[model samples]
Target: MTTATLGRLDAIDPAARRAPRYGGFSWTFLSVELKRLFRNSSVVIFTLIFPVAMLIMVGLPNKNVPISDVPVAQGGMSAAVPIMISMAVYGAMVASTMTGVTVAAERTQGWSRQLRLTPLNPVVYILVKVLCGLVLGGIAVLITLILGSALGITAPVGNLVLAGLLAWLSSLMMTSLGLAVGYAFPAQNAMRYLGPILPILSFMGGLFFPLALMPDGVQIAAKFTPVWGIANLSQSAIIGTAPDVWAIPNLVVWFLLFTGFAVLMFRRDTKRV
Candidate 1:
């Protein structure tokens, strides 16, 4: 072989220098996604700031007022305490679920095609997106908790920790629900549907209002909503009460259902491509 030809082959040789793998959980990608998310003014205001502001407005002024005949789970706890917990869950759910909306946008931009060309695993990509949502949700939770504490929404340390844990964990349901919605609909349509559905679900789940205060039929129906079980658990944590045994089944069933829906949608997309 000619010396020039040998040099050209050497320059192009895969054995000489390995191509960088794009697979796995990438911190660089994570950072980029986070920055992208934070840069969106709407996302920042809606997901991170709004919940805290709401708590301050509604909760701070009423911090000292004792809510009479609050629910059994609320025990002797001040109304502000339960409101803070619910808002934390509400914020976390919104933040995490909204992450799925990016999926719809990415699909519209053919980002999914670009992703398929890389070494990144599809599952890892999904996980990263979910993690981004979780991060935002966690930020909202922390901010709400800090503001609550500052505004005199007091609870035992253990109760605070438990409430946070339950609220955060329950947000996974919304994350999956968002993913399913994103995969099933166009970007604009996904958000449109979500805008109305979110508040409705939150209301039905008793995140915004107490199920105990609702009519008997509404209270019975609230049990079927995805947020109800987790909200109850969080409320019980704050009030130092035992969660109902039914809460376990409620959370598990809805989580699995949402997760399954997401998986089905993802698989359908893959088949189409």
Candidate 2:
């Protein structure tokens, strides 16, 4: 029989391992998350079908209405055009809630704790969750896009290619936000209260209403929430315009803040010897 030797594994600094270690997370983990996301009827109805319904609701009767004296050829183009952006923002918030529930549920099932016991780096575990959530959120966005196209909902000036890029980057920011929430709260109780949080933020997001319509100071403060900034950028893009420079920076800052918070919490959790 072959003999093996064991030594102080923990003492062998984690940095020495050039390649990363992971919890039970792998392609298997990602596939499972995707499958589970689809299986959840509420997620399907809310994140998936709800946007389509909203699109149709807004697209209706607007076919002959002019939004702003601009010939909307076959369109109000949906004054609810902003709702596409709003829908995405809404979905991402749901992503945060849903992903947090995913992690929390996984933890309840002992997946996270067991994975932590692996050779996997804590950082890798956190990264994978965030990446997985981003992918899920991206898929949801694509579904919304498909519905918009089928409904004859025109995408302002943005070509599909440009819009895709915007969605990818915005999803990246949102993934980080989701992770931050996932790390901050205990999974179970979070979901219980998280349901209400989305609508409040969506309203605060200024998606249904223009920030200009709000008080000046509220508009300024809304910039701190990544949702507001992305909503502004996406709405402008859909309206056939480029977002202002400041808007991009707002997204970047929130992205960094969320990333930092998530990493810090995950690292602390892994410190158990």
Candidate 3:
């Protein structure tokens, strides 16, 4: 080779050539994911429309019904308050779990394999999925809250805001659970198995009604369910009561459990590829 060609060859770093490209998280990728999510009309219908509709149907008649003997000014809230919050939680749960559909689709399309070929860390990829789920969940909660306000579900502004925050935070576990299910099942089967979990948990956790109204057996069981703590915590502000002492720990433990399960499944899927 000529001297100039030899110099050019020598300047190229072997280490750089061997290193993987596109290794870290990027906001651009997150934005693309969000946009892709919103493009799905089903997501909008299920996460936004359904919840608001349920809130109106259930909350309108109960708007003036007092939840307890205490007055609203003295800390008691309307029946509509809990109904509104529960529907919000329900919507958020559905939105978060929809992550499974996207993940399974990616796997089916060989996108997971493509990602594996890049320097992108698997954990970062999973984090991006979780964030997308959270964004969808947040939107679900917000839309429900706006509808609730219009339907006359009144409460202190602080309580309303706090309840909304708690409802959004409660979706973290659902996001991780969605990732776990997505990584565990085939594309077509992922959502089929995942769809009924939230509604069942909501019923058992007394999100649809007071635990006290449940049978003695159900009330006891509700205390141990994944949704119970977060549901109670979210509603406590509106109810003007202290949440159970176990609420925080319950939320933390379930989040860790789901996150761990998701990581394990992700590693397994990666290895399979």
Best by TM-score: 3
* lDDT at position 185, candidate 1: 96
* lDDT (CA) per prediction: 0.81, 0.63, 0.83
**If the candidates were sorted by their lDDT against the true structure, best first, what order would they fall in?**
3, 1, 2
Q: Is candidate 1 or candidate 2 better by lDDT?
A: 1
Instruction: Give the per-residue lDDT of model 1 (tens digit) for 79-131.
Output: 78888889899889988888767788878888766765555665566667778
Q: Considering summed lDDT, which 10 consecutive residues are worst modelled in model 3? A: 14-23
RMSD of 3: 3.6
What's the residue-level lDDT of 231 in candidate 2? Answer: 72
- What's the count of clashing pairs in each model shown? 0, 1, 0
The best candidate in terms of lDDT: 3
Model 3 quality (TM-score): 0.88
Alpha-carbon runs more than 4 Å astray in model 1? 1-23, 26-29, 67-76, 118-121
Per-residue lDDT of model 2, residues 1-273, tens digit only: 223323554357776766543544578766766677567676556666665565566544454455576666634455545556566555655654475456655555666567666676655566666676676676666776777667666564454546544654666665665565555567777566666766666567676567778998888888776677677677677766677677888778877887787677666654631
| Per-residue alpha-carbon lDDT of candidate 3 for residues 188-243, written as tens digits (9 for 90 to 100) | 99988887877788888778878888899988888888899889888886666789
Better of 2 and 3 by TM-score: 3
User: Which candidate, 2 or 3, would have the higher lDDT against the true structure?
Assistant: 3
